[model samples]
Target chain A: MTTTTAAPPGGRAARAAAPSARATGPSTSGRRRLAPWGFLAPAIVLFVLFLALPIGYALYLSFRTEKVSGLGLGSGSRTEVWAGLSNYAAALGDPEFLASVGRVALYGVIVVPTMLGLALLFALLLDSRRARARTFSRTSIFLPYAVPAVISSLLWGFLYLPGVSPFYDLFERFGWDVPSLFDGDLVMFAVANIAVWGGTGFNMIVIYTALKSVPSELYEAAELDGASQVAVALRIKIPIVTPSIIMTAVFSMIATLQVFAEPTTLRPLSNAISTTWTPLMKVYRDAFTRGDLYSAAATSVIIALATFVLSFGFLRLVQSRAFASEK
Target chain B: MRLTTGTRIAALAAATALLASACSGGGDDAGSDDGGSAAGPVELTFWTWTPNMEKVVDLWNSEHPDITVTVNKQDGGDPAITKLLTAIKAGSGAPDIMQAEYQKIPQLVSSDALADLAGSLGDDVAGQFTDGVWDAVTLGSDAVYAVPQDSGPMQFYYRADIFEKLGIDVPTTWDEYADAARKVHEADPKAYLGTFSANDAGWFSGITQQAGASWYGIDGDAWSVDIDSEATTKVAEYWGGLVEEGVIDNKPMYTPEWNAGLNDGTQVGWLSAIWAPGVLAGNAADTAGKWEMAPMPQWDADAPATGAWGGSATAVTSQSEHPEQAAEFITWLNTDPEAVQALVDETGIYPADVPASTEALTDPPEFFSNQPDFYEVAAQTAQTVQPFTYGPNINVAYSAYNDEFAKATKAKTADAFVDAVDAMQQITLDDLKNQGFNVSE
Candidate 1:
């Protein structure tokens, strides 16, 4: 709603300032003074409350520890003391925590590339003119987007069962040895597949929208110059949607870092998935299960900081190319 | 003339204040009690996860026609606790009677969030229930926080036809059990004696309890972890060996593979509690008459004959509007023979009330091929259970042990397995210490 209201006023200002800014340009001080604040307010408010406030709270909590004096006999014996960096040191030194983070990193390595690649391919295919049953294929592929991650994991979990699965049944009919998807080595892939199936369609739609926003005039010019559809898609369309792809990639990375629901839901089906299967899962275990919210809060802050550093570092590295045309 | 920014801020503040005050005023008005209970009928809300509570509610309603009881079907254990905690924190809209698990009873009782039911119920009502059931709901020694609902007596359910086919006898000792399992697997290359889900500590707990492993001791406010004891190690080693020998099917519970094992006869048997029979019936309808119950194998022939698996209790929350009525309903559900019978007839829940089981013992069902003595499981439950203390962080300890057990079982050698268990025990102790549990070195 704000986008609609703000666009008209913003466009008029942009048009008015364009010529003068283009001439004096390097420093559009007048427009820059009003533009940045007006554009940033809504996002800044959300970021402060949802992101910065919680991080600050967690940071404060992480540095504090409960001290129990003289047998901890009563309420008087227990007091809150400043812990400083002990909790962080403990969490980092923990073998279980390190192992869980390593497992998740490996899982992300397997999942992120495969999911984004499939999403990009599907988006390109949907954009192609000669593709058959486009609407049906698009809807079917995107249908999983409507289902919650937990529900999709449950469905896929049942399908992975040797007795219930149609795929397993076919394997049995052919007298082929079908290794259990829930076996120790393969369970990570099973969990990753659930996430990919649930997420790829949504990413595909984002990429597709970005592709659609690309000017058709570019394609027409390429066609007149005797370029193939593949060539146009590779050279023109991809370059145009690079920013969106990077955004999706960064989001996917963040999401993969916080993978909890799929693995948690699938735990009822596989013994290989420990309660501390992922870093977020370990945080949950520490907080609710172990009732060590102090450590849990500390671990969460660590994760949040890692995510911010990773996403920011990535964006900074890619900003020159992806955001170059914006200014 | 320039308008001050303070004036704009004042205008916004005044509007927000007005809106907040109006909302608060409305909330206060609705929260007030119009008159005393003597003038009108009292309506109480009862929240229960067990489906059998509907019949119990119906029985209660018929007895006291003037008082209306609204039974709300809440989701199972963890979600119910979360919902209750949230409602309590919000300071409104909590149910009067909540079904609580035994392990959670200590946490709830210690928090002083539950009403003292012992005063209202008295000895007559409490006397009829088994001591184990009663002890589960008791907080310290004398303060009864809740009333017991059902008993989870662990039993071994095996396929008789499969046992005969494999030429293996029902084992009385752990050694024999392993040998039989090995024989079964040799006979049918794909079959396993039982399934163990590494995440499930309930089954492991039952095994340890049968081996006479106590979790915690209560000697004047001090607590100790007995997980490093010899009995617990023996049980863990036995399970680990089974895993190595491939005698046990390592399928996760509630999975289709587990369900298939139950129905398709890929699994020879399962170690289940009293409630498991009902679960099996509910899940595997096609595998109806193929199942028969046997007692769980002992570590040695002289070991204890029984161990408790899963059970739940009903508690009246501190926020209850009618604590007296809630306590009365819970007392009857736990002790009254007729009420317990009604619940069993309605929900197939094996009642923990000793007197109730005596009366309900004759009821025959076509599900188990008209087995008239279904309550025999209850009798065994009462005889075999040794009291064990469930600590505040028992859930955490259970999960930690479960993960460790999986790791140990999957290990190549017995030494490696023992080392893994030792590591798990140390970590568990450290975790308990961190959570403010009184752990002895």
Candidate 2:
């Protein structure tokens, strides 16, 4: 469930290290190694306690299940039984799990591209000199990031309702018929819109910052060669920010894979989303709602592994291309 | 790179150490050898999601100054269960007492997270509640895991004004209900008899129970699951036909759209549990005095039956240091007249007591047109509700039903409902068998 939250904190440390790695290239590495390790002891202790322990325990639980002997009426009757690979086999073969995977894959296809494209567009707009109300627009686009996913889904859920929605009221006035947003086909877009709204801003900020880091002389050099502002942005600005864009895409994909809060919060308003709407929600249903911790643990491990492969695969693809030119 | 790798390895080793410590420290600190009667003031923690429960807790605290209880409000539904499970698995942070829904009792019992109160409480304790309510908390004949706090017997609430306008009397049988639904829809294109919420799996479960569908039954030591029985299929076909015919709007409940439908008379009635009156009263105050309650429409004209829906009980966790005191509090809170009355007065939760608290039956809120007749009808319905057992896999079964119901509603087909129920029954049966329980169709 917290697959999204787990990535961000770890991502923050990497983000913090990116520029500094270049700044302190070969200097002061060996001299302060022990001192830095001593200083990092508390963080290491906390990281171990909070993150690694829970993960290790989930892995251990994924391989074992509770078996009921007689009646299953008392504590003595139920015993933990080791069932190697069975839970994973069950999760993999389950049609519901496969359906959830398909739904999330479709969701990712819609959300990631739309969100990144809009973020790139907005970042370029903000970096341009002639843009109007840049501060207001930037803040407005990024504002949703401050609102939690649950709250934004709730806010959008109301706006999507026919009776309470101003948009529905407007549509009626215009004599235009519109289907309810909570209907089966349209509900996915409604959910995807919420994710895109909440995400584009943060990714925009990351890309915008990366665009700012590119030397002004590069743009000046391009402009001197009879280049337009769009040409400079499309060629010079975008390529320089490829690493940041790739990082954002990886993070967005990870978040999209674990879409729980939006669909869950929207459920009270829409019937389109089931309790097992996403893989993470399914894992949660198994663990707490069904009290099948072993199945839940196995599902989570599967999700975590999927995320690892997707993120690393993208990073490796981008690294080979980007670094080949650098070398 | 070297520094980063070193820190990462150090973090990994530290995490391993933390996990090892957690494993070794799994034993319960509150040993039963400490004796039941602990001296001095015992501070007990209680968690519940029911709003306005403060008055009940306050009354209990005032009465038992020696055993002060702290009330903490947790979120309802799956999230609350998640918190409880995490606390239990962590071997700490569990509240002594918590509110558990009736359907969740079997699951919690299987987890070994609850203490058996049958041995500690007197024999008369189980007899205080109605049969349906008592069976919800009791494992068999002897083992009681929780105290029945409130109940929701299925009831039909209709818009009296709308029925009069449509020139129709209240429906006594489901056939008449369907005819009225069609007439109401034909009379006003904007209105329907009721909205069918496909997402509301629990409500459908209750209706099926009313139709004499026993989804879960304990036969000796094994569990019998029949989710797609004749009765259940009948219910599914009836509702699925209603959806397909446009006699009912397939809208999700508890949303703004549903509320607007009620307030504006687009939806004429709600077929739900006794809790419907309170919810409708709170959400659509403009429709006050225009609504009336009746016993749920029967599947057969000669049969007088109902089903149970949402109700909760106070259960003692296994981690509690003072089980006897906790049981005493739970029993007193549920059975004692003052505490039960306080709960009704504060939260509008109808008591599950057999005799029916006088205060609950007598007091008529103005929101229901100042009529207390519904209370008596509700109490009678509560008594007539079919007693059934919820399996440990009930939640999973519920979600599976919800998934299938949603598909059936969307596809507008009776066959879809049958297929959904078939898949649900098969999934749960396999799951139980895999879990080492003797499950049979």
Could you report the Cα RMSD, in angstroms, for every candidate shown? 8.9, 9.0
User: What fraction of the true Cα-Cα contacts (under 8 Å, chains A to B) does candidate 2 also have?
Assistant: 0.41
lDDT tens per residue, model 1, B1-441? 011121222122223222322343343233237223466666677788887678778887888865667899988887777566545433555677888888777655543357777688867767766676777777457777888887787877788778877677888777888888888888877888886567777777767777887776566665666666786787767776777677776666767777777787877788888776677787777877777776777765665467787788888987676778778777877677778778878877777777777787565444566344555654764578766767655766777766775565445345645665576667766766875656666
Query: lDDT tens string, model 2, B209-245?
Result: 8998878888888888888889888888888888888
DockQ numbers for every candidate? Answer: 0.17, 0.25
Candidate closest to the true structure, highest DockQ: 2
Which stretches in model 1 have alpha-carbon errors above 4 Å?
A1-90, A128-133, A213-231, A291-293, B1-39, B65-68, B87-94, B302-304, B409-420
lDDT of 1 at B434: 74
Worst 10 residues of 1 chain A by lDDT: A68-77
Score candidate 1 by TM-score against the native: 0.84
Per-residue CA lDDT of model 1 for A1-327, tens digit only, reads 999999999999989997775657546766667789889999999766545555555666678776543233322444568899988999899888999999988988988889889999999999987889988988998889789878888899888877678899899889999898876668888988987898888888889999989888898999999999899889998999899889888888888877888989887777667888898788777655654556777787678767778878989999999999997
What C-alpha lDDT values do all the predictions have?
Answer: 0.73, 0.81
Each candidate's B-chain TM-score, in sequence, is: 0.87, 0.92
**TM-scores for all candidates?**
0.84, 0.89
Error of 2 at A67 (Å): 1.5
Q: Global CA lDDT of candidate 2, please?
A: 0.81
